[model samples]
Target: MPNVSKCQSLYSALVSRFQSENPSLVLSDTISSWLYQSIYSIYETSGEEEAERYVREAHMV
Candidate 1:
């Protein structure tokens, strides 16, 4: 699992990329909240190394 600080950084990067994909609008609050939860789920299920790799592979790291 990722530490809080690392998770925060990864979440920000993911959200940024998500928003960038739709320049005209951002994700809904509901979806954004889901994203935060979803990332943590990945970290929890996959462990630190794989989770970090998951984000890094997406250029989030």
Candidate 2:
């Protein structure tokens, strides 16, 4: 969303996965917002490596 190249795959995977999980949400934009919030929170509190780990673990779950 903000041209953070490293976040591209994380954003795509999160948007796709969350949309599939919560069909009732009905808005990709909402999911994108949530994803950005989650990722930025993790990035701020934990750092990029942890954020990437979050994305990888999300795929597992």
Candidate 3:
């Protein structure tokens, strides 16, 4: 089972790291909202493994 809180925390960290690393690139609120929705949808429909995989992939690239 997926721990949604942990996932949320990890996601937040990932966003922060990305923002710090790429200071010039601004992630607007709309984009963050869409990404969060997409991630949550994946977790609900695809299961924990897929959601984790997606997060890992997102972090990598």
Candidate 4:
């Protein structure tokens, strides 16, 4: 659980850094697209439970 939290924090920080560097980036749109891509990729290569967890965690952030 600690590792999961760490990864989430890292992911959030990376997203924030990217947004700060690219001021024109639209976070909502970018995150939506990323979420779609992530879900599709996960579904293609991993189990449904893991994919669902990822989506849930991402949303929680």
Error of 3 at 27 (Å): 1.0
**Model 3: CA > 4 A from native:** 1-4, 59-61
With candidate 3 superimposed using the best TM-score fit, by how many Å does residue 44's alpha carbon deviate from the native? 0.2
- As a TM-score, model 3 comes out at 0.66
lDDT of 3: 0.70
Give one digit per residue, the lDDT tens place, for model 4 in 1-61.
1234444444465456556667776668777567555655664566555655664555333
Instruction: Tell me the number of clashing residue pairs for each predicted model.
Output: 0, 0, 0, 0
Residues 8-43, model 1: lDDT tens digits: 777787767756866665667897787667667778
The prediction achieving the highest lDDT against the true structure is: 3
lDDT of 2: 0.70
Instruction: Indicate the residue-level lDDT of 47 in model 1.
Output: 69
CA lDDT of each prediction against the hidden true structure: 0.68, 0.70, 0.70, 0.55
Q: What's the best-to-worst order under lDDT?
A: 3, 2, 1, 4
Model 4 RMSD in Å is 9.1
Cα lDDT of model 2 by residue, 1-61, tens digit: 2336667667677767766877665545776687777877777777788888887677422
**For model 2, the run of ten residues with the poorest summed lDDT:** 1-10
- Poorest lDDT segment (10 consecutive residues) of candidate 1: 52-61
What would you estimate as the lDDT of candidate 4? 0.55
- State the lDDT at 56 in candidate 1: 57
Lowest summed lDDT over 10 consecutive residues: which window, candidate 4? Answer: 1-10
